[model samples]
Target: MKKIVWLSLVVMVLLVLAACGGGESASAPKESDGSASGDTASTETFTYASTSDVVGMSPILTNDSVSANITEHVYEKLFERNIETMEFEPQLAESYEIKDDNTWVIKLKEGIKFHDGTPFNAEAVKYTFDKLRDPATAAPRASLLEPVDTITVIDENTVEIKTKYPYGAFLASLSHSNAAIVSPTADQAQDLMKEPVGTGPFKFVSWTSGDQVELEANEEYWDGAPDLKKVVLKVVPEISTAISMLQAGEIQFIDNLPTEQIKRLEAMENINIEKKEGTPVYYLTFNHSREMNQDPEFREAVAAAIDRDAFVTKLNGLGVRSDSVVGPQVFGYDESADEAGTAYDVEAAKALVEKNGYGDKPIKLLTANRDNFILMAEIVQAQLTEAGFKVEIESMEWATFLDTARGGEYDITFLSWSNVTGDGSELLYPNFHSDNVGSSNRAQYSNPEFDELVVQSRTTIDQEERKAILDKANKVMIEDNAVVVMYHGIVTAAMDKAYSGLELDPNGKWTLKNVTGE
Candidate 1:
């Protein structure tokens, strides 16, 4: 009986070992020689966290940075701006030639197809521009195509776009995601907002509203299949929550990292930090529609009262004090001119306020409820109060704030613009031009001299001539206190060390096509 019991125990232990070994064999890649494969390739899903909800995928409908960031990955423009060179390179279109001052002939790339299997050609380009130009669409970026008079499809692969004028920034505007090519077939979808179809490396898989957006690698991508098989953009409204997710390995990348947590994040092991000087100017814009803000003295008083250096300190020294509307990354930024602008002078501000007859007038400073905006507004509010203005701070959610502010409801609203085109015209034109009042010109600022300078800058093709025109416009706007140009934010992002090949563009774009999960 003892010999039989010992034999049974030995058999049971051997069976357990065999089962464990079989499980390992199933997980490991097989070799023809029946040996260990020794392959080091990884197949991991990359998760990125964003602080704001992506508004939608419609290229022309939204101008928010968050929407642009997401659309960039899912759409391919006729041209793309090189991150290092800051020059326009062909993406959807193979090549382009300026036929004359107003006409540009573009050659489409052959054999490229949208994700919906629609052949991308001259007709597709024409369709995209037509949709954008149509008044019924009411595309928020419709004004971008106002100069484009006609898109003529010369052939299946050739297109000619004629502008109303010789627009110097035409090619640069094409580089924007708002000018991305779309599949005409897919455009028929009743709910195309949730179903974006483009020739990008990633295909939209699912968008769980505000929770997350998921994309999968397009194996048939024209460029090549992406290394990462999947991408998940998890909407984390709070930076602190995103930080916790990053530490817990729930997210691999976190964009727009709040400056307050950088030091703590840097201390963590296997975490990488990427910081690039971006071309976004965070400023306080006045609604010229308001009688009080319409006064130049009042605007100058508000600009002179706030200490930009103190504001930068409150931002945790994460940005450069912006003295001009255009940042250094743009084409026409003038250092001397920027430096010669306004300075913090309490007495000067008070004198200007008295001169403007703004005594005891209730000035409401409206701002988004985001951490940075609220904190910055509070500081500005205190400064304005000390300067003897009846200051009040009003905060609301981002979407609500944008709607209310753009409707000319706010006396002073805090906002920012990411100059994604890398052009001084992009920074100056839409926001200051009188025609752009309902659009990017939230301030309702209109000056014929500034308008003429901007129009001349956009028309002239000479690089130096354009710079001179834009510099003059910047000087005029700054001297008039068009807006209190606060500072340009530094593009700061954090990622897990496991993720590689992430590149930050100076235009404040987060490029993820080359980024891979190790």
Candidate 2:
């Protein structure tokens, strides 16, 4: 995230920052009241400080959070989760009916048009999803629709979904950003990332690679025109500089704040700080490819050695320790599963280590060279050494770290996952399912029993039955000790008080919609 396209954009940033008056809030809300066709919501640009540039605009292909955040405004999903109430609501689709355990019928909202002026109908839905289902697309999030059998357009405005199984998380999965409807005209665009067209609150204007993305309000938005005329997501990798920009009012909003600077942000006038209960979990995961790590007892021993409480303390009481990464914000989060999990017991760990006889072997703990991960790794290393284990630490750049960890090149790695879909199936299916061993399931964990339970949880239609199945699946994995969850995080963000209607999700992601800046 420290990457800055500074050499070329230095002059541009200087010019922009100079124009941004010291302590001047978000650009004026509007010239007119945004009620008429000629009316524009905001006259001046409203800038947001983003830690990194968006990876891509193609919703199906984009895997990173920064890109997804940008796309959320530019694209509309068939269903959307209410950030406040945690309920699923229709966006592109008007309504849906469950015909049976394996079938669903949805009626599209009529008269909607994409930014490219293509009529949004059943064909558009079929086009986008067909691309997602296509193997050539190589969509990273394709697993989110693994149970889908077919998407059939029953009529111009109606669509029928047939799942291979009775997938219970289908509705919740549709709410995911990956399920966004793209314009059929998007296929004609030479560059998918640069020329994204969607039916959303904002339309793309420009994307300066690794610098900023500019968007203008969609006055023709089906929901009605947003109160803001323009939005700019600027890449300012340094958190300190971003906070300074917030203080100077050069930027209107910033998220994923450094935990240390949150108090400083809270003290700033006209700056509103928001902390939402979230589902992002940073875990110390064991790579089951290693012989020593494959044993459940040894894995449990390592889990018992680490002090999970110390992690929160190390972060200055800024995080929540979770026995289960399935946080309260997500469905099927079992409180009892947490109660049944292991606790810190140095003596028990030492005994297990001695019994396992792998204490003399060097156990490498790999992590990215980020400050937070390094700090947590040091703590883990110290505690494990104390419990009669030979521990070694390895840190690499973020990109290299991902490549190494995802390929099962490390014994233990510091990693994180956000169950943004608000479903336990999202948590289990990707992270634990043996089928995902080389992909999202970085741990290389393979247990047929655990896999069966997760699949069963998703195939069941009843929520209670699914939850029970998920609870059991979680217990099975917890016993196997594939991962030692450090903590579930809070989504921290800073926005000028002049702006309202900024939304934050439980995955530490913030979105802008209908924001009115005074």
The C-alpha lDDT values of all candidates are: 0.81, 0.81
Point out the worst 10-residue segment of candidate 1 by lDDT: 33-42
Residue-wise C-alpha lDDT for candidate 2, range 1-518, written one tens digit per residue: 23466655887888788887565434333223221121122335678887667768988877667788788889989998877777889889899999988899999999999988889999999898888877788776777778889999999999998999999898888988888999877766656677788999899999998689999989999989787788899988677788877766567788877766767776676577788778887888899878878787888899999999877876654678778857666788878766556889999999999987868789889987655677789999999999999989998865567668878999898887767778898888888798778777888888999999999989888999999888888888776777888877777787777667777888766667756865
Please give the lDDT score for candidate 2: 0.81
Q: Identify the leading candidate in terms of TM-score.
A: 1
The residue-by-residue lDDT of candidate 1 on 257-297, one tens digit each, is 67778777776564688888888888988888777777778
The per-residue C-alpha lDDT of model 1 at residue 4 equals 100
For each of the candidates, the C-alpha root-mean-square deviation to the true structure, in angstroms, is 5.2, 9.6
